[model samples]
Target: MRNLRYVLLAGLLGTALSAQADPVSYKLDPGHTMVLFSWSHFGFSHPVADIGITDGTLVFDEKNPSKASVEVTMPLSNLDTHVPALDKHLKEPDFFNADKYPTITFKSTGVKPLGGKKYKVMGDLTVHGVTKPVVLDATLNNVGPHPMTGQQAIGFNATGMIKRSDFGLGAYVPKVSDEIQINITTEGSVPKAGQQ
Candidate 1:
């Protein structure tokens, strides 16, 4: 009876340790992260815009990928179209209305692993006071220690598309192109002990 109890305790302890080993928490490294969007400009060329991320977190579990999730918040005021006049126009009531909305956010609802390091992430994205479902096709770029910082890091590249009209940003419509293509490249690092 004593031997059986010892074996059972050892098995329970091992199971607990294994369960804790897979999921890793990482904080978005803002300086090394980028979110950019491009849209057709009346058949002339594709114009690009930059949206800066305020903060985010990603929880990834390699062993059990279904448990992974990500959440990000972006400041609307940080949007840059590179053209001053156009940038101002985007903030007006006709477009983003930065003063009213203030920020945009995304929170994952589900994750589907597409074989190897690729995943399809379905999430709720809020923009211009409107929330809609969005899907991102993401690829894991790298996951390891950073050479410079020596901290555990993970990198990913993702692409997603959103229709401006769906989010109530329908200004020029067909002329300016309602569909915007988003491209994101980000690096996140594991937080130190006791840190958020």
Candidate 2:
């Protein structure tokens, strides 16, 4: 009976220690993260643009992936479509209206692990003053020490689709393709003790 009590106590202690291993929080390294978007242009060809990430935080737990979460902010005014004229037009009231709504944001609602290093991330995406639920098929690229910063870092690539019309940008609609593809590649690192 005494031995059984000792075993139970040891098990409880181990469980407590493991639970204390919370997910590490990573501050986005914006310079290393890239946000790319592509859309059909009148069925002739797909035009792609690069957007800039302003800030974000990623909390990840490899052992208990359900605890993973992310919050990202992208500056709408930083869009680059290669063509200067078109880029300016895109920010007009008819399109993104960057002046009125300056930033796009995404906050994770849930994360479901799919096998090894793959996850289905569901989140709320706010763009152009509208909010909608979005899902991304995410893959964990790597998690280790970063060569430049030497901080523990994590890399991920995620892909998701959104409809322009859904967000009230229905000017071209089917003609220009209402659906847009978003690709995100990011590397986040644990900040230094006082840096955060």
lDDT of 2 by residue, 29-62 (tens): 8898888989898899999998869899999988
lDDT of model 1, residue 11: 100
Highest TM-score, which number? 1
| TM-score of predicted structure 2 | 0.91
- State each model's CA lDDT, in order: 0.92, 0.92
lDDT of 2: 0.92
Candidate 1 per-residue lDDT over residues 35-72, each given as its tens digit = 99999999899999888698999999978887899999
